[model samples]
Target chain A: MVTETDIEKLALLARVALSEQEKEKLRTDVEAILEYVSDIRKVSGGEERAVPSLVNVMREDGTPHEGGVHTETLLSLAPKREGQYVRVKKIL
Target chain B: MSINLSELTIATARRHLANGDFTAVELAQSYLAEIEKKNKNLNAYREVFDDVLEQAKGADKKLPNFRTSKLPNLCGIPIALKDVIMLAGKRAGACSKILEGYVSPYDATAVSKLKVAGAIFLGRTNMDEFAMGSSTENYAYGVTKNPFDESRVAGGSSGGSAAAVAGNMSLAALGSDTGGSVRQPASLCGVVGLKPTYGSVSRFGLMAMSSSLDVIGPFTKTVEDAELLFDAIKGKDPMDSTSVEVSSSKLQVKSLRIGIPTMIRETEGIDPDVRKNFEDCLKQFRDAGHTVKEIELPTMHYALPVYYVIMPAEVSTNLARFDGVKYGLHVSGKNLLEDYVQTRGTGFGMEARRRILLGTYVLSSGYYDAYYAQAVRVRAKIEQELRDVFAGVDCIATPTSPTPAFKIGEKADDPLQMYLADIFTVVANIAGIPAISIPSGTAMREGKQLPLGLQLMAAHGREDVLFEAGKEFEKLRDNRGGV
Candidate 1:
């Protein structure tokens, strides 16, 4: 069962805010969903998850495009921007 | 002469365009008129492009060069795009308020290829927020109603795309499928939908819902039209390392074996009419001199459970980018932490946030090993089981959906009941195989005929087998004459 505290922590980890009402509603919904999917616990496949060789899989001969070719279009989408860089609140 | 839009196919459209039966501009006007008439009630398209006539006029110029082989098959055809797909300079928000009004910076690989093939974009269609839900009710926009019955839901996350084709608003449409997003809606709308083999079509432009299982598919009026759209959009791209080349195939399959999975008999929630229609379809196949056998995939039932775990885990990871920084809706809070939370809380719909929370929970420290890790193991087992089953049969057949289109808002409040709609369709995604949903027949619902679909799944890189089987079944369905 998912507790209120658990849903709160999940909200924090996922960077989503929730009200008391949404939290209570989400708690029950998550609990029911987990119960429905509880059968996944019975799986005993002994092997670890497969990891493909994505590293070094890129082609070498393809020509790289010029840098900042789309800087105007890319920066235009930002909510807040100054010059070329996107402005965000200070971390510290 | 007024063109009968419902009688049109990509093949017929191409032939007519070549023979000068009608100009591309006239064709575009026809579809635009249809959308203007039907879309208000059906809620099919999110935005019908303003440049449709211009695009068709350009194709008209190319028609003079047809004998040079420069003319493409789709050169004047009108197509709808799911809102999740990126077309450069066009808005694609995945039907979520978070990315509302966010214009795409570049064309998705498929959209770029479609432009090259001479297809005109009709516009973006509606979908579930972030392609998360089984029905389009979760969209920030209004729910997409069934074209046949306004009281019923057009099955989703690609509901808008399916409805567009089914209602004849567009000749064909492109949709992204993660766990039956394309096939389910196609089934409910009584149109043909194809989820090609994983990696067969490039996903460079589609919004990520579950990267592992995500694939872009087509919704069309006929299986042949589905093949045509798939052909235009498929190929490897340097931008997407996971994309692979799907060769051109003109396969003529003869007397192939089709498997009816043993789980079908045991699974619950299947409507009685759905089962009866499936049996009638099997009987037709048997009388046509094809082998019909019941095969077992021991881990078949585990597919839905594993999907719920793995999908959210990937979703939480993929959706983390929408932190009000680079693009989309931004809400300022006291600090950076509050900024992220507030923006996501208000921006995401209930279904999107719910999946995000479920995904975050499974990947959390204590529960990761139990839920996410275990799901990966079971997923692998399911893949192996499907491989074993496919070695014996060329294709696996089942009802595309357990039931036909349900009334709008019927399952809106219950997430679990909505999730059950994808139970049969998720197996193809889990195994990374090709699957197609063809309209099998219809069932009487509230005195209206609601269409049902027969889903055929083939082994990996075996879309040719599916296309052949689907076309053959279409012949039989035409003779029977119901849907």
Candidate 2:
């Protein structure tokens, strides 16, 4: 069973703040969902398999000139921006 | 006389445009008028693009010369897009508060192809927040009601797109499916929806939900429209590495063998009306001189549970990009970390939060092997079983959903109950194969006829089989005077 403390820790890990009420609700919902999905435990002894015919596609390490078409547009979507850079809180 | 927008299909509209019966502008106006009449009540479209007529004008210029000039298939057809699919300069929030003000900087690969095809964008459609819920109730915007019955849900995460097509607001719509988001809603709304092979369609510019499981597909009134949209949108793209070349082969309906999963049909929670409809569909196939046999997919029972584990884990990771810094909703807090917590807590809907938390739990250090790893192993087993079944059968058949559209708020509070809506549809995504849902017939619920769908799944890269069988199924139904 997922306890309130465990739910809180998960919230912290997921970077989502939950109120006391929401956390309590999530605790129950999470427990119920986990219980339902615990059926996966019944299946045992299968080797890890990757999708067949899939290959690692590699591309050259340089940006194409056509890719720059969206640069200014992407920068404009930033909520907080300075000049051409996206602004964020100082990590230091 | 003005064209009837309700009965207008891509093929018929194209022919009319070619004959100059009505201009593209006239067709666009007819749909816009219909949307105006029903959109407020049905809540199918999140926003109707202001430049719809302008786009129609562009298409009109090419329509007259279509015969002489090389014209793409979807020329002048008005289409709707699920909000999760990015269209350049359009608001695509995925119906989530977190992306409330985000405008896509570029078109998704599929959208770009649609533009090249001269298809006009009607607007972005509503969806479950980040495509998380089986019903559109989780949307930050208003819930999209079913066109057939206003009080019931339209099935969801792609609910709004399905509703738009079914309600005559758009001829067709594009929707993303991660665990039946497209097919389930299409079933409930009584339309055709297809989820192509996992990597057949490019995922570039689509908001990631479950990266591996996610696919962009179409919802239309007929299988041919679905195929047209699929052909226009599908292909390997330089933008999406996972995209691959898909080859097509002609499949004869008479020679094909369809597999029916006896185990899944006997599973508990299937509604009697749905079972009846499914059995009737199989009878039609058998009567058409096609062989229908019972095939056992032993690992299918674990598909839903495996999907829950795998999807949420990817969801937690994919959605981590929505911090309050670069784009979308940003809330100030005491510190950087707190800012993320506050922004996400306030912005994400309840279902998104629950899934994220569950994902975090499953991927945690101590539980990773027991939950996530175990789920992966079982997923492989399910895929292998499906591949083995496909070797013998041309396609597999099932009900798109266990039941018809439920009343709004029926399973809102209960997550498990809602998850059951995708039970029959998720195996296609789990096995990374192509699947389509077509309206088989209707079932009476509460004295109203609710639409039920027959789901047909084909082997990876064998969408031709689905389209061939689906068209034949429709013909059989039409011959019987059923829609």
Candidate 3:
């Protein structure tokens, strides 16, 4: 079962904030979800044998440039942005 | 002049449009009327463009002068697009309420190419929310019904595109295939569907489902139409890094070696009628002077688990953009975090939520190496297996779906059962190869005629072979006078 601590960590890792109520609810929801995936854990060594396609597909070595969706488009959707970068809530 | 342009093939419509037999406006109206008449029964369209007539007027004026002898293939053709593909100023919601009322400001690269080629856009078709389901029943707008029988599903998440073509609401439509989304529906609806090789078509403005597997192709009544549309839309697009330059070739039969994977035939839960139809397809090919062989690609057995794990992990990452703060549906909360939690919780439907949660869980730090990493490794193995098999065979054939279209809601609750719908189709996606589904025959279940699809897969950049094989099959079917 997911605990309050687990919810807090997950939310933090995902870069989203959560409240006490959400934490409580997600604890239960996430716990039930984990129960659903428990079958995967039970399958004999399925975790060790899996693989994905697109192996070693490396990006071309060139000047790092952001392509598609200009800064105007990106800034258009941001809650706030300093000249060019997204402005997030102050943590300090 | 009163002809339904949607009912005209890409070639026929061009002929009529050039001869001044009918104006584009009249052609557009005929299709609008047909859509009006059939949409309530088929659910093939989500939103019909209000300015289609205006666009058609513009197209009529822009018809190029190549001496008027023969016109461009797609000129004045009304084509429907799956809801996932963006058409500027049109809503491309992918059948989800979360994106309701969202209009694309820019057209997708393929849509833009089609527009340049003088193809008339009918409107956006319906699809499973986020292109997630096999049956279009998961669509938020409503389920798309089979044109043959309203009680059955049209197959999904390209159901609307397939249904529009099959029901004669449109002659050809663009649909994206991720796992069997495009092919399954085309088979069920008894139309031709093509999924080109990965990087064959640009994915520049499509909403992401599983990025690696998604490819935009066409659903049409004929192989010629599929080729015409695919040729026009496919090429290198700078916007998509994966886009490749593919040279179109004609199907040649010096000596074609066709592989029928016995492993898929022996897969659990294959319906008897589908098996018989698949066997008949093998026999037909043999009789047609092509060499047919049974090949073993045992790695195909693990496609589902690998796909499920890898796709959700990708889903977890891709769906992070829909947190309600930036441009989608938002539910107010006291703070930013509360707002995000509530918005995602309520805006996403049951299936979406399940996938997101599962994806999130699998991609979590500690579990990433175990689930996500391992799945990627296995994916490479599967790709190699495909390469090994293709070394001996010109193409592989299988039943598109183990069974024909089932009733809506039959497999909705069973995710595993719903997943099996893609068993025959996913290996192509996993291997990043080109595949097509052509209607082989029809099966009778409970006094109803249901369509069955035969799948043909070719090596990367080998689409001509598929079209050649499909052409012979199409000719044979035509001579049989339609099942």
Using lDDT as the measure, the top candidate is 2
User: Global lDDT of each model?
Assistant: 0.90, 0.91, 0.79
Tens digits of per-residue lDDT for model 1, B32-58: 999999899889998998899999999
Evaluated on CA atoms against the true complex, candidate 2 attains a DockQ of 0.78
Off by over 4 Å in 3: A1-92, B1-7, B64-73
DockQ per candidate, 2 decimals: 0.75, 0.78, 0.18
- Stretches off by above 4 angstroms in model 1 are A47-56, A59-63, B70-72, B247-252
lDDT of 2 by residue, B1-483 (tens): 578876777888888988889888999999999999999999999999999999999999987677466655677899999999989988889898998789988899999999988899999999899999988985468889999898999999999999999999999999999999999999999999999999899999899999989999999999988998899999999999999889967785466799999776569999999999899999999998989999999889889999999999999999999998889999989888988999999999899999999999999999998899888888888888998999999999999999999999899999999998999989999989999999999988778889999999999999999999999999999998986
Q: In candidate 2, which residue ranges exceed 4 Å CA deviation?
A: A48-53, A66-69, B69-71
Model with the higher DockQ, candidate 1 or 3 = 1
Q: What TM-score would you give candidate 3 relative to the actual structure?
A: 0.87
Q: Give the per-residue lDDT digits (tens) of candidate 3, residues B1-483.
A: 567543577777777877888877788788888899999888899878888898888888876552263544466778999989989767777787677557676789999999878889998898888888888886357889998888889998899999999988887899998888989999999998999999899999989988887899999887878888888899988788878889767666665789988796568899999999888887777876778988988667767777777777677678788766555566666767666767666666656665665577678888886666666766777777789988989899999998998998888766667887898998888888999999999999878889999999999999998888787777766676754
In the range A1-92, model 3's lDDT, one tens digit per residue, is: 66788666665545454557756766675565455434333333334554433354456788655675555754555444577675544434
